[model samples]
Target: MTIRSRLLLTAAIGMAQPALAEVTLTRGSSPVPDGEALSTGDLTVQNEHLAFTIAVDSQAPWGVPRGAIVDLAPVTDGEIALDRIAFADFIPNNWSAWPNTGREVEIVTETPEKVVIRITRDFGEADIATTYTLEEGSDRIHLVTEMTNRGDVPLVDQMSGFTLWPDSGYILPVPGLAGVDSGSAEDALSDRVVAYDEDWFIALHAPYFDRVEYASKDLYATHTLAPGETRSFEGWLQVGPSGDLAPVVAAEIARGDIAAGSLAGQIASTSGPVEDSVLVVEKEGVPYIWTLTPDGSYEIDLPAGDYSVYATAAGYSDSAPQQVTVAADGSETLGFEDLKAPGLLDFAVTDSAGEPLDARITITEGQAPLVEFLGRQTFFTELDQVGGVQASIAPGDYVFTVGHGTGFLTEGEEVSVSVASDETQEVDVALELIARPYENDWYASDMHHHADQLEGTTPPEYVARSELAAGLDVIFLSDHDSTANHGALAEIAEMRGVPFIPSAEFSPSWGHFNAYPLSLGEPLEIDTSTATAAEVMAEARRLGADAIQVNHPFIPYGYLASLEAGTVPGGFAPDFDLLEMNGPDDDDAVFARAAQFWTQGQRIFLSAGSDAHDVWNDNTGSARAYVHVPGGVSADGFVANLKAGRAYVTRGPLIEPEIMFGTELRIAPDEERSLSFDLTAVNGLATASLIGPDGEISSQSFDKAPSTATAEFSITATPRTEGEDWVALRVEDTAGKTAYSDPIWINPLGEPDVLSQD
Candidate 1:
């Protein structure tokens, strides 16, 4: 049957009465093979409306070892729509049985009408068996997990369930919430959670689950299990087309049999029937959300209980709660009175050039009538529309702050305004650019940034928006082990007139490396499963990477850590192009290590990045690389300059030395040269030091000097006893932010250096 027809049939089944359909289960190789990633004992299950593949043995990167739903798509499309869905860790016990564990799969039941496949894993003291079942005529896959304690100690406060990865740009629907992004719905209202994108949706109906938490790419639920006894938790997975979720909801309602009563209500405001409003019904402190029809009328099935009902809309006040009691199989009708009209706040933000500037807007005093989710407190201008935007907010006195990211001077840009009901207020904000590194042919880029990879909470569009707002000249996308957001970021970069570099953080068991300027449409060729650091770098180079970066080299899982301990597999390969100064905390350590390499006659340059994942909560470009792209900021130009070591790493301060770092100067012994430094900091400069292999050569204290400062130093070229001598600048601001410049190679003539040794 065609996928279109199957969708139609699924919709019919959802709307009509429940009927039985045949289900088939097959065990063998994966129907959709991903190389040699899956075990030979994979399972494929399908009904009239749904289909899925369970990886009995997963060997792919980041794959769950066994019993993970690796591939899920509509029976019609047959395309992979999900990454994977696997069991999460058991709480309190703090144990996860999947991913690097042994498991046994058994066919517990085989019948034409019903089929059940159970996967069992033993965790020494506890045994868990997760079963997948599909019955005739059912459009959902039912999953039940039973955990039993086998050891002498009793397991207490145990909770375990599955985690779902729906990729990026999926909306999550729960009781009391609609149109919430999957990452923003950390806490939902009901047991049924539906994540839908423009094409398809996957729903988790867990009537017995106690709570669920959502990250950017995945979400997991937990159910209470008792100790010393066997406990089973049940859930249903449903998939369908996007638009309507009726089919899944209907199946859940019918299976659970909890819809014993009905509540009908009408929501009306002073302006008449409220449109685009939400009806919230709370029973026993649990809130259920219902999307109202265009006429502001809603009818919902409920269990016998007393509920507090209210209504809320974007541009209106929430209706007063009305309490009503419902009997078994009974019906009740309730009406809501007036909902206050919202006031409008229109803002116009401009840059120093008097052009419309895309800025970040925040409400300091009063709250906006909009729903508050993760990172929703701040709004960006020109996100959906060009120029200024208007917001509907509650009528009150408010302090609205408008500004760009750190590079702009918006210190006193807060405006106070009183909003009246049904009134419009206008506010204007003008911001001045403070740090102008671009004018000096320097372009700033955050080397390590993520969007919707693993636990990342920011989407691609927001990633672009946030970085642009942070005044970054070049945008880089380096999601861990995935280039899924590369194309999207590239397109957005084109539209925003910014240079973009496509990169991915090759996450291996050993460490993580970022390979940049990767070609689009090319599959990631590097596999770190058993490859050494040197092999990974070779593969990255073979895959057409212009530069390979060692990320957070001094951290626990960093490559430098293993190299330092003399435990790096295949020993240390100094073939990497760049080494990261890594955010704020690792600057000193990384700098010290880089100095050692410099004194060893290695030319590995320095790079800085915030390693920002949740851009909404954290700032991107907090630590950035300033590269000298004198020609222009293009992907090729940036990479070329970075390869030549024409760059510096900074957290906030900007340093420009007269004799630019990365310049090779061949001088006679005892030749004197004068060097001048131009430094700028948003939060006043503290000190500037000229550093060499032996330590500080000369230093100047700024005493928290304002915005900009300068210093000059005269030094003589000294004979190198061993490796070539090099000098660099290190500056610290009063805010404790630091910047490190690439070394200025002081190659004294007739000295035994890297060249002579070679």
Candidate 2:
């Protein structure tokens, strides 16, 4: 029998009747009044081991009873012994919110030598019972659970549950299952702060870990259980003292790798040709169809509109959604690409020394060539596999070049190619690289996050790995009110060459603010964290931060407004510089509002932040954030871009709207100044804003750029009291677009002869 089954067996058999004293004082005292079957029937033991006590306070349904305790430091019984437990100190630590924990608890030691622990709130109760038996000269503990409802119906499949051990750090046994659903708290999707959320448990949500949560790369999984009418689960909690127990439990659960479960939904039939076990299709209101079965000519009937279909089997994947406009005939072929779909070629790069680079490479204009492979049209690409390179292409001829940041490849390096869909082709190119004129650089980083562990969530590696993959320039580890994980991430980022800024998301009663360059210690823990909006600005300056940023101001975690009261106990206000105008997957409202607030919060510099704990979905960020250093891309480069106001956020467009000497320049203390744009429409519409043209003080309305019909328009600058000032336009439009020009220094005429011309 499985260990779980065996343990549960003991619980069931012992509770067959409430007779026999049902408990003993092997190590402590109880609340059952010792030999008296008293009132609510709750059992407890206190100071049973060393100086601590274990208590289980049970009460009548919908009510709380008094707790009983027994001090164990005074016990001298050496033969029947056990360690003490602290059930009351249980607190879940994770990124997302879970059920509020309950208080009153009770632990029972039955006469037949069984341990029954029950924790209750006014609404419900959960019971875990274990019996110790002597077998073959060894003592075995059998455990089982029985839960009851104090209200009308069963508790909805909930995210309520808890399990922990002594802080000394022991590996959790495997071959076992979580009492709550085994979904996940964080995964590649939540950026790991929620930690390790995977595709398997689409709806289930209680996360499970084997010793270390990250062991899943080796430990595998199968279908997760859903809560039904009295559904019972079983597993073995193999005992082990140390080391990762993932492989050990995985092998014991199933002999081989066939553990991922099959879906029972209507869409399960469509899952067959999918790769990586993932399917991505965008529809207005309908959900995507998923199939767990292995083969079928799946047909999707849809009402016309724009859509994207991505299918994956194992890890092979394909994507491209279409927006179909039905003709007068009211029909169209929303082609489902099988092996016959347009081919995708993976490209890779590395350093001049031939090291492989993990970066996003874009192919534009359909001007790139195609190659043939396996008797079909295909595109060729490459991946840096252990320092080597390769490519795949559809059968065709065309010229190709690279864009965005430079790697082993340079800009405008054209290549012509042709291939038959039947054969594989091999190609290799070497690169000569150069550094930028500037010595120092700037960086990019996400500065807000929370840490939760009692919930089996918050895998730190996901936070580290996603940024590495997304090409984020840097990251600031700022857990609210603490820097506990700072040392660990710093060491890890160094190995990855990404700067780990010591930061704090300190808040006051007004708003949330971030402090950077704070020496990787406790420089900014707050009484509020998001309380005083102004204080955040002041703190950033006091701490010598290169920049201060405000975190998500629109995420209504049920506190859209009315947080000034303790109703929203945790938030605070803070000081700042830059503001997060954009985050990963920020919607238009979120983006627009952030921009509006930053414009209103004039003294703060504005920037984009992806409060992402996961970067598994960063494909939309191709043009992400790139700063054109008068040098190379690095942490220093990112910071410099922010300080000089040379940074613009985008996924596509590159805009360059500058000021000419005569047409766009004017100088006057009280009168408005005007800056002109020679303007070039490089890719598409570029939106520009005149920033701090008035003494590091932004003129209102600079946040949202009015839709511009032409490529250039003169922003009649709003001038503030100024001596020698700065002015520049920040612009960006739809897909892959952006532009930030150098600031112009406007010198007022009568302010002393300040002209020094050679």
Candidate 3:
């Protein structure tokens, strides 16, 4: 029998529970029954326990075409637990166009007891049909997807699955692993993964697959399909109270008929059982971790396979790997022995003031034990610790490096010391302050940053720590499409005595914008779905945003590109306050675009940001803006100064112009004035140039120059035929670092300037 007939018969026989399933269609602000097709409204399926809302079209706030689950909430408390969820990114042709492609939705089966909605979308050579089902008295939603190869070529490396954006929290749990770091996908142990918080939990279960792949919030499985072949896969989305995973696991095991084998063992050394030991079981290069009990015993259920088992712990050396094999539904016992004792390294880092400094410490030479569960090699000194931090490492000749971020004078000081087993070594290092821009009322700010949002892996605490380690005076939180990390980031920034700005990256189909200095707890009022760029900026202003910045305007899906292509409705709106010089890599194209706007008499200022999403792999403040806030780096003062164009964008060098760019300089026609600039680079200076609307007006090249240099040139204010005339400064360091100053308006007296006309 068909699925609908089976469900209907079940309902007729009274085997189905009460008819608690409800289906609704939402268009604009009105919600109606499921059958109505009023311009592709969003569809919501809800049972007694959970509710799932799917955006039926691209006009939804999540900006995804076709059926994308945008919100999930529990019935008891109607709080959203998901930002958005979708199935995407089929490999071997790298087909990721589902979010931008149009599709059709059909209500295949609809009843009070059960409902199933089918969505179909076609690529050039492939077609996919996905069905979502909700049933009465069920806490989970079921999914079945079929992909057909329509072209003549065979599809290889075929893989696709759900991409999830939990509204908050980054704790991901898999079978045989308690807590897996979301930043890395090396430990995908099972076919199920759960993203949970304190109040709600959401899990993806694909039991047909033996292993799962997770990275940047995407969990999927791999398969292959030949030409004219069709492949079908089944999965489920389970929801539950809190973070309990027992129900999900049990259901997955029963559904998939998983015949998991058991591994039970003890970890011991020469003296006795190693109470603090952790067992690592490796199968196909994927590790399943188990923590031992107080008695040094561990038991884990694993898929039947040949495996290598070992033990590692703090203050102890790793044991040799032992190989074993198990049959299906069988049991095995394995134990490890002869773990060597460890030596301790006690280290302290201090500032020039002789006070304890919170700095990053790295083991540059010797092999450090992978004591950190995530296998991290670097360590940080705690702010609350009194004396210093201690690490138990393997006995060897190790070099320890200590320093702060790029803002500090020294990169780091390395000291080599020989250590013996079961011995303690003490080391201390002092860091000197190189340049204190804050003393001169200039604050370094990376205006764009992210935490554990979509495609981001670092948690809020780590985000704060990374930015602080970068020695930034101002911290800005601008995670994509959400402000959930603002409170946590603010608290950490307060504890660290740094200024914090609450912001969000308003992401839409056209491009992305960073709206900053928003009030805490203010609802994200701007509609990110159908709002045009002009409307988005207007909404940000209406929501009391201090500044709205166009982010990465020249890259793919960037605002400038959209405008140039005329893809954005109401194209070329000059409502934005700042334009971004994104990341550390210099983009000459972006500079040329900004200069073009400046020549067109637009006063859009330039700012810099690293756009770091994963702090574990990327630097936070690699490219930053130094804003001139005379009083301090308060949110209000910083935004005000940034809007006034009192900021310079830099990767490493620092530029101080005699008359800061963005300031109007009044001069008579045919009058000449001397322009001076002070340049400083951690690396030696290479060249400095004075730029104008026509071209480079004056320039100086330096060889073997000190870290600091001065450049002075004379500029004559000639009457412009049209538009406005402006002068800017650009400097490059020997290390290929670059800095650019905002243009200084050389306005002829009795003539209207760009800002004056505006």
Task: Provide the TM-score for each candidate, comma-separated.
Answer: 0.68, 0.43, 0.69
Model 3 vs. true fold: TM? 0.69
Pairs with steric clashes in candidate 3: none
Residue 445, model 3: lDDT of 82
RMSD over all Cα atoms, model 1: 8.4
Put down candidate 2 lDDT per residue, 299-391, tens digits, no spaces. 332223344444333212233334444222133333344422223333444546775533333333332211001111112222214223234
Each prediction's whole-model lDDT (CA): 0.68, 0.34, 0.67
Order the candidates by lDDT, highest first — what do you get?
A: 1, 3, 2
Give model 1's TM-score versus the native structure.
Answer: 0.68
Q: Give the alpha carbon lDDT tens digit for every residue of 337-449 in model 3.
A: 77767777788877778877666677788755432432345666654562277877766677877766553234567778776678988888787755667777878888888
Model 2 C-alpha lDDT versus the unseen true structure: 0.34
For residue 325, what is the lDDT in candidate 2?
Answer: 40
